[model samples]
Target: MQTAGSIQAQMVGRSGVVATLALCFIIALLEGVDNQSMGVAAPFVARHFGFSPAQMGLAFSIGSLGLLPGAMLGGRLADRLGRKPVLIYSVVVFGIFSIMTAHIWDANSLIFSRFMTGLGLGAAMPNLIALVSEIVPDRLRRTAVSFMYCGIPLGGAIASAIGALSVEGGQWRHVFYVGGFAPLILVPLLIFLLPESRNFLASTVQKEGRIRPAAISTVLFGERRTVLTIALWVTFFFTLSILFFLMNWLPSLLVRQGIKPAQVGVIQVLFNVGGAVGAMGFGWLMDRTRAWMVVLCTYVGIVVALVVLSQSGALGMIYLGAALAGLFLIGAQSILYGLSAVYYPIVMRGTGSGSAVAVGRFGSFFGPFAAGELLAMGFAPPLLIGAAVPLIVIALISTLVVVKRPVVKN
Candidate 1:
């Protein structure tokens, strides 16, 4: 006779699994659109409001501030409640706030709206990672997670395309409208079609009888998991910082580098395209090799790519460098999500993944802020790109540590 766990796993067959994956992918894609929409519309928004660069940077960072709390609350709630409810509610929250963004009149209002939107984005992510991790076959789990994550860059590319053609022509509010409305449309489908995580129901609730809420500290650092948890946080912090720095500032920076206004969109699209490819390719490699080894190599690739970008004056070299950087930097971050899923058990998976993201979101806030400060100081592109090298090196070393001392599963 099949055990409860085995039966639950089997309940969602191949087609059901595929459907779930598709839903998760769409959720992630919407998240990408919602988050990147701000960056894509930043130049236009700044001009419209007559805001200074510092004010714009603050606007960018403020959204991430909301994500910190959102991730923490959402992840724990998902653990205590069910993943489906939290996931659905998160989408609703962000969608409503995103629509409100279209009506903002000043810096403060924009910040408030984006911050509220961040909460939903933050909450939805951990559950998505945990759900995808639990449902997929063990061997394919990493690849499945990575595949879902590719939606982030794909959405970014889509946002960039829209912004280049439409928003630049003074239709910035349309970006937010699209971001807000599409997710609202998805909510109905999510309500009707999304299934509760079987593993959360079986392994978490059934095993405990009554849910004993695990503290974030106890869940992450308990069972001698401290070193691994810390390393994961460090890795997440640095990688996400770099990723967001580029995501938020790259277009403006490229324009400042004498690149034509029209060409910035193409570079952003190319960057995201490379990111999607790298994420899928590295994910495949992670399943076959030492996962840390794959991550380490990716960070090294990021360093090399940054160096080339720093020195390049030619358009081809600049484009090539951006693509390579995105491939490795964004790709490696996707793999880290998969790694976080693998590190925690079903019971604490939401908390573990969410906490890591919360920490990373803290780091993400600094990326755009620091870039703005540096730009204010008149720092050149080469110096800004060069600064990322040490962070990537730190990430590379952190991966080595994770590999050497694996976290004990709870």
Candidate 2:
């Protein structure tokens, strides 16, 4: 029979894991709010500054450009220093710049502030993924990570609701204000409540000073990891291209399509709401069903949603299409993130996750910029929406290849 002390220890361990997930979820939610802030406020900001389509697109892409370096550096630093301190600093950087976004006097200032904010957000992501991955057992990896990921879309939904409320008032700056302050408020809680990953600590003791350039190359390209890394990069690139494109452009596209701002907010909310549901639902399914099945369902749903969105003119159809798109697009991203966390050993998990995210940041940067350029060149919104289908198909194929390889849990 198990001893009472052993039973007590197990309960404490379970509670600790729950607490960790809860904290990570809150941070992820804040990140999502900030991530979606530009999209929610774009129309109003455009009006405030008289930004052209190309210029607005540039602003969107500039912020994401910060993410590339931030992710690379943040992941590297987390491995060198630790996840908690790095995450704390990242939150502070993003929060301050996010508030600065509310006070920008010109387009130049706005872009700079947003870029700084994205830098902070970028840094936080890999740490969050790494931290959560370490805390959970292999059996619950997808489920745990997916649960944490759900907070992101839920946060986006909250931002969309705020946008809906502020539409008539033109209070666009309030979105940034909320996004800024909430994370700052949560900092104190994180400092006191969050625990550092035991796995990270254990790895540090076992292999001190292994974060060399040579080691990184080996982790990424050595031991037959080359193909896996390439597949991951391709999957992240194409999938995030479509996902970010929709996120940054969808609201503006709806407005241009003659949808009312209020209705557009509703559609945005549905999109994020669908995303939240999909993140959890698909994540759960991944743990139980075949990985290829999830991939097929996710990408196929994306294609169908995009087609429906492109063809739909009525408000109801638009909402349905947007929701479906959100469901699959965000769901697919969560799956990719979970896989990224699982693919590498614990020692290099931060680096692996960070590098993949940085590459995805490139996609995030290009997607909005490309969409903006095309729109400025007089491409129809429907055609642009449909264009994402080809990218999704490519990502689907790459993801299938990735899942076929067996993963060894660290």
Candidate 3:
């Protein structure tokens, strides 16, 4: 690690969480890029291996599969091992596997590498989210989580922009090069600049006794928080199911629609632009009112956007609909994360958020595979309409009914 001032020193007066936010955003951005990066590269890879779109979809799903286990393991690791080591290990392992993905030649090796990358990527977040929530003051937690989630859109847009540019000459490998290299650049910065979360450290101690893993289990899964955590997980899982479907399916689906491959990236940009706007906007909204309320409304908006996008034949209408779909779809998912920060106390924060994210990760894993399966069955673009994404999310949000209780649990 670099010899910069400790996190405690940096967090001295008040500006610490801001710094933590920056780091968390970077981590979240890298995670998002890893998640969607394969989609942008899949077309070229399919052509190279003579694989069908369905096969490619399965491969993309494998990366998400890795995330499922990683999320579970990473969360526990963060609780037991301390957040810094877990984060560092994930970045290094994730980066190494990502680079390996660019080098694999056969389908099996490629799938394996992608899956491993998913594991590293999956492992990183719980620690990061857990760390970030605890590092900030209660008043800032929601906003901080919201801001970090914005990385999803920014990273997706980055992939689109990069893929669009690099794929100009049909050199898809170049896209992987950028994806694999990005984390490397951040690896050193993370080691040098980032500090261990004070809250996570403090969490090691409890009221009745010292911080035991059993205490965390009881506090989170005891009587009250378990159902709430499950609801949060369902909310994210459904949101991701549709979100991943769109991220991976949109480009190929547009291609099948007779839209130019080049223009597909442009379409992705519209969706991501809307996502950034929605996430940022929703984050601000969460601070002012109940997170569940904001998420519920966003889901409704997404349903409307999807319905319009699915049916609208006009390009302008399609753009507007996709953008609006992204706005609701991405923002609603992020709002739950904001809720996680505020809903749990500092001690159980990582375990709380980690459990939700870990469970939600299966959606990330299954989403692309389902899209691929649907497409393989010769599904029509309109049939698999954009509205499907938000529809699933609406069901998930209905499960997360948070009471407007106040404790300031600081």
- lDDT tens digits by residue: candidate 1, 209-286: 456657778899998889888988898888888888888888777877788756888888888889888888888898
**Candidate 2: TM-score?**
0.95
Q: Cα miss at 388, model 1 (Å)?
A: 1.2
- Candidate 3 per-residue lDDT over residues 1-410, each given as its tens digit: 41222344345344556666787798788776776678777777777778887778888888888888887777776766677788888887777887787787888988899989988988888777766666767776667777888897878888888888887577776656666677778877777777678665544643453345546567467756766666677777777777777787777777767776667787778888789888889888877777557766787787888788788877778788878977988887677667666677655666766777766678876778887888888888787875375457555544446434343364
Candidate 1 global lDDT: 0.83
Q: Write the per-residue lDDT of candidate 2 for residues 270-349, one digit (tens) a residue.
A: 99999999999998898899999998999999999999999998888998999999999999999988888888887788
lDDT of each: 0.83, 0.87, 0.73
Model 3, total clashes: 2
* Best candidate (score: lDDT): 2
* Model 2 spans > 4 angstroms off: 1-12, 206-214
Which pairs clash in model 2?
none
User: Which has the better TM-score: candidate 2, or candidate 3?
Assistant: 2
Question: Against the hidden reference, what TM-scores do the models get?
Answer: 0.95, 0.95, 0.90
Q: Estimate the Cα RMSD of every predicted model relative to the unseen true structure.
A: 2.2, 3.6, 3.8
Poorly placed runs, candidate 3 (over 4 Å): 1-15, 206-211, 215-220, 386-400, 403-408
Error of 3 at 301 (Å): 1.0
Candidate 1: minimum summed lDDT over ten consecutive residues — where?
A: 401-410
